[model samples]
Target: MLSFRMLAPALIALALCGTGPASAQSFTDTQRGDIEVIVRNYLIAHPEVLEEAMNELSKRQAAAEAAKHEAAITQNADTIFNSPRGVTLGNKDGDVTFVEFFDYNCGYCKRAMTDMLDLMKSDPKLKVVLKEFPVLSQGSIEAAQVAVAARMQDASGKKYLDFHQKLLGGRGQADKARALAAAKDAGFDMARIEKDMASPEAKATIEENFKLAESMGMNGTPSYVIGKQVVVGAIGLDGLKEKISAARCGKATC
Candidate 1:
């Protein structure tokens, strides 16, 4: 492990050179060495400056990423919130839309399902959309295909939600077999599911979800787009509520 004494000179030099190659080129070897020594000594004596600089860097990076998310959200607003490729639940005409991209086999999504359900029950004005993002496994792809087929046979989303909860909340690996079982239990037409799962719409729906997720720079299950912001992980129910409230009425609670 390099100590601060070992790293200070390089850090200071990098900071100075970060401005431009011209400024670094203007300095002679001796002058640059002298500058590094001075800055290194000052930084060592006031170590808090390093922490402050790093905090500032973090803030700037977060702001840049948020700006990127906002840009993507604006560009894809119509498809993201209202595309028929996704399953829409909750208040259809709600002011706030909570969109989730999830793989059936994801553990975090299994846990997050409760949050989605709770929100639907508690907040009548929040629109929730579920998109199949089957990136975890081949089994996940198979399960998603069945799910898409289920949705095709049930436009009301009632049976689809039941199938979703059963397969996602189940204790085992989610594959075509388990998904079919869930659909059967949810009272879906198995023959229709088997036939529909092979349809172009099933493939197209999953393809559309992957495209949407890629556009938003989403790479994991349970990623969300609430209002203008992209939330990249399962932030728990309370954390999710804050994001929802921020979108709903410009506050953490509304």
Candidate 2:
């Protein structure tokens, strides 16, 4: 009486060693039926094995992806953290840098904005960079163009942040019109903003952001890079704080 777990490998080996098609193979129909029975009974008796195998597979995949992201992060360090195209939010000379690639129309990005703000307020020495990644719609692209133009109008990026908060926090869709309205409310030189929105520099900056995102394997909004980790989605305040703390020191809590 072989246990189901012990029979799994034998079943696999038998399948592999089969010489021909399903209609004409090494094992007889009776033998194949027995093998199937063993597998089916074993799975019915112990479903935990399936869950364990799936968990192991997930772990292996995550490890491989992490390794790949680490390599990409190293390869794109300059464009990721030090690019002039990115808008700075916190201390310029902070010891740790947190970078966010976001779309204005992305709901998750809007929610994650609060976490970013809270982190910046609590950590005076943390550097925050915002990369405009407008991938949602044409409206998103238009909003991003306005954002880039606003950043160009004032190199400090002070006005850009204000415009960002207003539009992302505002109701309804965030298109070129809404973004321009936010820009005006943020006290940007409206005339200059409109003028620079069409400038090649603005277009080039956005194109560079898209290229960087593509190289880093970022296909969605609100993706993040903190320390040596590439975090996707809105991981919340605690998650971000832990990564930032880990970057500053060696542990999740510093």
**Per-model CA lDDT versus the true structure:** 0.92, 0.87
In model 2, residue pairs whose N, Cα or C atoms come closer than 3 Å (at least 3 residues apart or on different chains), thus clashing, are: none
Q: Candidate 1 has which clashing residue pairs, if any?
A: none
Go through the candidates in order and give the clash count of each. 0, 0
Candidate closest to the true structure, highest lDDT: 1
Candidate 1 lDDT over 1-254, as tens digits, reads 33666666667667686768788678888987787778778877998877887788899999999999999999999999999888999999998999999999999999999999999998999999999999999999999999999999888899999999999999899999999999999999999999999999999999988988898899998999999989988999999999999998899988
Clashes of 2: 0
Per TM-score, the best of the predicted structures is: 1
Candidate 2 residue-wise lDDT at 138: 95
TM-score of each: 0.92, 0.84
Worst 10 residues of 1 by lDDT: 1-10
| Residue 237's lDDT in candidate 1 | 93
lDDT of 2 by residue, 43-72 (tens): 789888777876887999999998988898
Q: In angstroms, what RMSD does candidate 1 have relative to the true structure?
A: 2.5
lDDT of 2: 0.87
